[model samples]
Target chain A: MSESNLMMHHYLAKYLRQERMPHIWCEGCGNGILLNCFLQAINELNVDLNKIVVVSGIGCIGRVSGYINVDSFHTTHGRAIAFATGVKLANPELEVVVISGDGDLFAIGGNHFIHAARRNVDIKVICANNFNYGMTGGQYGPTTPLDAWTTTTPYGNIEHPFNLAHLAAAAGAVYVARWTSLHVRRLKASIIKALQKEGFSFIEMISPCPEIFDRYNKMGTAVDVMKWFRLVSQVRHGCDPAKAEITENEILVGEFVDIEKPSYGRLLREMTSRVQDKLKREES
Target chain B: MVDESRAVLTGTHFMSGDLACAEGALAAGCQFFGGYPITPATEISERMSRRLVEVGGVFVQMEDEIGSIAAVIGASYAGKKAMTATSGPGFSLMQENIGLAVMTETPLVIVNIMRGGPSTGQPTMPGQQDVMQARWGSHGDYEIIALAPSSVQEMFNLTIECFNLAETYRVPVILLADEIIGHMWERVKIPPAEEINVVSRKKPKTPTAEYQPFKPDKDLVPPMACFGEGYRFHATGLTHDEKGAPETVSAEVQTELVKRLADKIRKNAEKIVKAQRVMLEDADVAVIAYGIPSRAALSAVREARKKGIKAGLLRLVTIWPFPQELVSDVAKQVKAIVVPEMNYGQLVREVERAAKTTPVILLSKLGEEPHRPSEIIEAMRRAVK
Candidate 1:
């Protein structure tokens, strides 16, 4: 590629760690598309890059933290949300975001996810729901669809999958949305909305794990999976997230919940100020 | 920044060891506390929840010990002095993230108020069983500083020391208290803020463009750069080079990084290690102990001296990077060493390792009550024989 063509095509180059580029994502993996959408969202917002800290847990999507140019942390498996909570609560001025995988966010880290959402911490969570544990060779995970074939589930996945949108909404996320990797523009728009929200916001990006999960489940090639996403996707704004489940025939996509309340950091600051004022009055 | 006046609690007061530990953290300028409620350590969290507010700090009661430690590490990386308190079971849950803190070189403190446990063997009782786990709990080759406080005063003083060691070395420091000291109410003198010694993590002096997050100075410890510092650096649990990018496949990177993580504490063990030597100047028998058992060991040493047995005490204040030189020196002079622990013999193994040819007697006690002075004195008598 010529320098001019490279400059034109890789406009989001500034948002990535160029030295670490040619990421670890497999060929035809949707992780790149998801990353592109996220970077585009960040680019469109034009926020101070210094203030953003991206944290990720263990998985293919977890590598996103390492690839991002900002101050990032690739934390332990299933701990991105918990770690992000600490970061956001410690310094409210820093915009803490967690980008991790389904197994990381739900299976091993399920309790932390719910509790962080329940506390309404002011952090954005972007979960790349590739449906199985992609990094660990497509073992079945918490979000693995029932009857889906995986490494651990040779015959079929018997475990019930979590409807992540419903889980986020039920666990008290102030903003919730879901989009497949095929919906690039809409996903980018939704990411921007989630980023702008003041309280806990969650956006589930249904990505394709072509080399591992799709291969085991016979979902054809990565492009074929993208076509499958297009065939089944339906946009529903402000619908009850409880009704938004990903079945073979239909995958509910779009903004399902958006509301506002005092975030954990805001309430903590309020309480601290109130207590400090009380102490002052007592001393005086 | 904390208002120094509100933080110190600056006076003599009667309080439990757990409360004193919390107050000590406040005095040390700890601005973030993430913890879970567990036996013998719950009071620390309760006190932190109330006091962290007055000092304008953040206190979060996480869902579990794993989340608590993870949050503590997160808060530390965001440039706050952070800590969490738990007992054995919770400490076990915290091991993985504790290792994460070690690899990422995040500074934090963990106070484990130990209870009897292979698995919840005792809850309302004291034990020194977690000492070995504190050293090797996380599955990796890294060194951590563990301080054992024997009294309410030491609980307060050593909790502050935990923070200082953690910040200065950029490693997780464990305050190994036990049920006896945690719940025991006693007088604690909180010194004025200016008189107190507090250490903060060293920040990078180099320009942002030239910064390498894991590049150490002559001290073998790197200057930390927190999130939102405009450094735009990245850190991970995976073995990485000086640049802090993940380099899992490189044998040299793994060797260099892991060795530094251990050597940062090992090379500076002399400065980090602390212990109280009592009457060991001319003694035939030496008693080695820590935490609650150290108090009994002290009493036993005095009792043995009264009986003309020439017994003395080597009370370990810093339990990890195991203080081998101190034990070896004492072992050479003494005829025999007596190790009385609350568990089925944890640190006794360390004493034996350090004692070399010197006979090391293990007086292992298991129960709700600590070893009686007579029991330890009896062991001292047998050791001298």
Candidate 2:
């Protein structure tokens, strides 16, 4: 198939709410590309659509949940992971996926992110790293590089950015990966793997916010940012996440960690059954 | 399905108000508890942690109060009856998601064991300070059901009632308990599960293809569908349409959504509001109080009656929706109303509004100790004069 034919025949239309489209993302924003990638991943996995819930926090990425044609939740700011945790625990049969932005996940909601990962809750968290708070007009976030310019950091962000892959791995996520929107095929594959993972899984997608982050900096447009990513990105499988931080010149992107652990719901069910058994034995 | 064997703890036991609250939740078919440990409210979570596990339920100690309420709302969406307990500061943290719960119309029970606070003023001490906050803590215009329990037994009874009310109205119900009632221990009788009235949210009877998630019936409450129940509907905190889709720039949608959210509870105030009127039929002065202060008010009313003073007690069981009609009715007949609250006259404003012509005297107490019966009697004497 030709590239145009492939783009025209993409399976994403069926996964989106027809009326809610044309989405609210800016013309050159990378959120649309990320959403397409996510839908593609879901299509490839062939997961039961009714059993899948997409939960999002307050951000530009958070709006994705509202647009998706699935059982979704657009929760309070920075609470997607916490809410997803509840959904997973309440019904282990459902697949809870959280798609939110860096500031929503790791800044105001940093505590919940780490704790959910620590508990190894059965949920997939996809963080769109746009270097700044895109929805709130490009404020400096936890993932904003030390010298990157944001609206909140006019003199350059003095604070250090979080190495999200390292944070998730250290916080006990069973699967962790990072990919840029420029690497759509690779990012979708990683999302598929994260979705199939048993325990808590996290994927950080380094996306471009051309309207805010790129404009504040001297980066040209969304196309320019994608070109920069393609130019600087290096695929490194099983790279130590601590050494896999994205700098101005280098973007290390690949699968960093995959392991097995009992998820929170599994352990909770085990404990509940054991307690019930004991009660039955005592009654007998 | 009331699982009598697993849920009911049918016996009289000496327990604190917090423990009774946990037991009440379990008896009311609450299967999930998401909470963080805070002063006074910690006992409730601790008890829930042990008891919920035994009852084949899930108990999660969340990182913070924000996460606690968020988890409760999530559990409710996934078709589990869930609750969380907190004190003043934690309740303040949960205000954001309380609005989320209101906007999404998720049924949840929140137990706010009130402490002295503007900001963690007295963690170990008691205060009825969050009365107004319970009604208006969250941003924007919305209504809530808050019940103030004055005794350990009432804590047990009201927690169950709060859950039932939450399920019935599809709104977050608050058990506006205080530190004193939470810590106070008393004998509580637990009825069998068969006898206990447990209300669950109505589920959608329509097929997935036809169901509209936010389409309310005549009672103004939409039937809920769980996440994995083949009901592929979206829920958002933003202003949404009947299909549960976010429709942010539409003024008509916003007006209809907000009005429905407030009116559901306001319209049902007659069924939601409950109060105990003691010696009110032939009294010139009425003592209007709730929570721990109401105990003092009851004593004062009895003492004033013995002293040949025409005083009565109007103890508030359902604090929110303000019981305006009942208060107005009492105010018209009575010469004066004395409101004795632990904080500096919070609920007295409501009484003053309700009792327009009659003087509503405020007996404000702002300390660790509750109001003494003498202090309330003195206020009643002043009101009668």
Candidate 3:
């Protein structure tokens, strides 16, 4: 067996839920795929799983924590990031991972997502971008393709979907990338890199939800969803997201930027040290 | 009304419940607060912000309730006993991560000055509709300690108790003061710090390497190691193993984890519960009151005594656990019990079950106006008859 696959099996056996053997993720729902990739990466890094905190918010993607066997927090609709931020700050040494859906991350929790990214807190954020809110039936989300059919927006949507990469990149995320679930190996590799990177790393995985987004949009099962992702994904690093758009319907998929910035914790310590030093000098 | 002839010291100040809730939090050694200004609880956020700054603590008015709770949690992790207060609408916004504070076993106090609403029902008005919601608002079956103080003094004292219970159990404790208690002001004693037994969270004495965030110790709560302590540990909302990580999805880990989280509060119910009883001895009938309505009831109970009615008042200091067992005991002696609250009938339901021998009387002032003692006196008299 390939080393990555072998490692995944061991980790899955040691940590994953074989009982919920088949997760509720759509047949091709990249959520399980992305979750698998994340687990694989956690193992690859050989992170003490005990010291790894996984927090998820609401939506199909929010169930990621329930599926995994870790110190996991499945929070309310959009507060996973906030909760994750609290857990991370409360114990900065723990590797905090926030996994959620596009809607859970941006729409309800948009404020927290921006602030965390802007502060560059040490968090690895993986958002499963299915272009719709999957769990509550198909509802148009911030990432839902404009004109997509969902429960809320029966007519073709006029609202432009948020390019998540653009949002994170603009919000000062030091490490930002987008990848399709089809690129499992690459997705796993990016998760590893994101975990290892010292600042806020946002990796958007464009998974498809067939039952809701697909059925209403007249697309077929999970296979068809994966096939579509395979057909129209692109990537370019250090390029403007506006320019990196594929055909209007498709999303770009690849690591856009992986540069380092001083983390908030480091800054806090440095400031503390500087103040102490100044105090000592003055006393002397 | 001339107090200059009085020998005893007194501050007969009139304030709303919102002001008292903030003052109570300040007395609790809360060093950090993050909240957005929302009705019925706006004054709390405002007072905490000003006082926190004055005391070298922090008060960040975040973008919203979600951010407010996040910042408060962050400050706590930074080694400060942090708190946040909000009413119904803002309280709804904070539920997502409030559960996180539950799972991570993060010790912080949330003052949910509950307002009227399933969603924004009574922002300016008062509502006692959040009692059930407070007990089970978030999506988990985990236990939480909630205190409902009747007077400004209880508000001040119980806020400290909430903080102590949060630290003692290493879980989030809710100060379920209503909009009435949050705004209504009364003279409260600021006891000397040493006089109040403060229980700080267990700090890791062992090396950071040996620290397990959720290790079930003797107290059913593990010692917490904060950030910058060099202790590496994971805290999550996931169903985790003792070490606080995602564990192998085994029945054993799930059972053990859930049990410890629950047992901490359940086992220590005596230490966590608080209440006040007035003139219970030799009383044939009683009135149960909590939050601001109880203040009115206290006056009414006193008035009834003057009129030769053998009535006493039982103030619920700790609302959750319902003082259920306490009320049950009181139920046996009283002919009928009167539960007068601001809402339609929140606590009276608990009273009915507790007081099986007595006909539970409910005096509900469901509208925006506060429940006055005159109304409670009438209920107490009717129940006695």
Candidate 4:
């Protein structure tokens, strides 16, 4: 409608469903920033948008799939990876990306995540780790830090948080990386790398849930959390993921693992052909 | 395109119901199977795991029934005819995803080989106790298509029918089998693939730019466009509009979406529901049965005829949408209706409701044993008196 508005629209990614915005993310939430970084990575990769399928589970970040103008599936809670595995196996040509929150990807869907990684299925998993489950009134989840305050843990969370990058690497992900919302450029680059990787790739984003997570823990405003991320975050490329755990004192973030192996689809195809050959030989 | 020579194991073969079901699925053009091994249903997956590879199909043993059904639904959305098999306990775990499938209107098949159960009641034993659970297992007001197979032959035949119904209506179809039929070995005729009818989901004929995922056609069924086909539409379990976008706050959208999801099956009940009527012409007494119990009923009817008593059998093939009109019509001709089920009065409740004026006798047999022919004949005699 206006000259400036029209100019801004020109800069937006073509993959984004503009009509679906403004999204339902809370004001000052880092999910928007993470989404922008993801879009930027896709734009930089110059991927065919028609061949991309964005899948998400039930959570705040799961809404990301709906906002992206791709063949998307907003699936049941914690089943995005399982669903995405089917999508990938059904058609190896499509690029299946699962974007969801920490609770959905790690807690309820933990088994699927581990199994998919172990099988080395070709999928890009982007988990937004905001420490608490923001959509369900800020409940404590698997990623909630020790002593972190949440609605369910009003006193303090006694559970230890999962170092997601370490878990991904341990579970056989070919490429694993982690970054906070403050590290937009690094996050974008890592995302592009994961998207290009052959086997299972995972990227964990330590995002800010300012309205709930931050408000409960007295972690100041969203800007304060961003500043804290800048101060405490350390990026160590090619470091051992186990040594890169996030704590109250420091946040370790980097590209921890990047390797090559035969993907599940490739192996499955080979096995099928081998079996077919044996069957033909036996028949002869 | 299904290759009959490759997929169909033609001619007669003595096979278990579970194995026959797997063959039936293969003949029906099912390309994907995601399943977990549970008692009585394990043979189906084992057969599938071996046979699917030869046909260029995928068989994945998922972590549990929840993931199995989720993967099946996902594969279905990705343009594959997918299915899964489980027994009562695993079926209980799959109820959540069944609801998800209902909401998304994803076409897939689930074979529940029933056992005695409220909770793992009898894994090795046979029981048709899941009749009511099959109808009302998942939470919500949505309708489902469930078929009951009586013999090993019917198990083969009805598995194909279930897949056809699933793809025809774009709803999850259940082959509500039991351990008796699932484990029983009998002769099954593997029909030529050309002789068997298979249905695939209607794909969007319009351009991708104009395709709406949830917009129903004249039959109230929407054309599906798979992922990687460039349709670029969204699919969610939430209350969604015709464009496949979530519209949770709108009452009109929720009502229209849910009503269409249910009405599609209800309106097509005549085309979906099927039953068999044997010797109902001049009979004053009838025995209604399904699954394993129907075999006994058939025998009992013949014995009653030999004894100079007018008796018939109404075998339920399609259990859901409850064949009310058929039951009512049969009720009007018969003075009494005898229902012999493996459960304590599950389907008999529907029988009683439909046969308002007629005396409906329940001959429920629990535990592991099915109703003997003599036991059903005894019930029929009492109903007549």
Candidate No. with top lDDT: 1
Expressed as tens digits, the lDDT of each residue in A1-284 for candidate 1 is 97656844787988888778768999989889989998999999997999999999998988999898999999999999999999999999999999999999999999999999999999999999999998878899999999999889989989999999999999999999999999999999988998888999999999888999888888999999999999999999998899998999999999999998999999998888888888889989
**What digit string (tens of lDDT, one per residue) describes model 1 on residues B73-124?**
9999999999999999999999999999999999999999999888877899
**CAPRI-style quality class for the chain A–B interface of candidate 2:** medium
What is the per-residue lDDT of model 3 for residues A1-284, given as tens digits with 9 covering 90 to 100?
Answer: 97556656773666674444456676767787888898788878888866776778877887677666555656666777776665565456678889998898999989889988988888889998888878887888887777778899988877887888888988989888888878889889889989989988999887767778888998888888778777776656567755556344666777777777998756645554554456458868
lDDT of each: 0.92, 0.91, 0.75, 0.90
True interface contacts reproduced by each model, as a fraction? 0.83, 0.79, 0.19, 0.64
lDDT digits (tens) for residues B181-295 of candidate 2? 9999999999877889899999999989889899999989999998988888899999999998888899999999999999999999999999999999999999998999999
Pairwise DockQ winner, candidates 3 and 4: 4
True contacts kept of 4: 0.64
- The local distance difference test score of model 4 is 0.90
What DockQ, between 0 and 1, does each candidate earn? 0.84, 0.69, 0.16, 0.68
Candidate 4 C-alpha error for residue A208, in Å: 0.5
Ordered by DockQ, highest first, the candidates read 1, 2, 4, 3
User: What lDDT score goes with residue B196 in model 2?
Assistant: 90
Residue-wise C-alpha lDDT for candidate 3, range B1-385, written one tens digit per residue = 1011111112444555666666666666676677888887778888775555444445556678888787676557656788888888887877867777887788888888777776868787777878877777788778888988766777776777888888878888888877766776667665555566667898877776666777877989888876445554445566787666556478898788777788888888777777888998878889888887877888888998999989898888888766777898788888888888777787788789878867888887775787777887787788787
iRMSD values, candidates in order = 0.9, 1.8, 8.0, 1.7
| Candidate 2, residue B143: how far the Cα is off, in Å | 0.6
Residue range with the least summed lDDT across 10 consecutive positions in model 1 chain B: B1-10
What would the per-residue lDDT of candidate 2 be over residues A1-284, giving only the tens digit for each residue?
Answer: 96655544666767887668668899878788889899999998988999999999998989999888889999999999999988888888899999999999999999999999999999999989998988878899899998889888989999989999999999999999999988899989988998888999999999988888999998998899989999999999899999998987899999999999999988988888887788879989
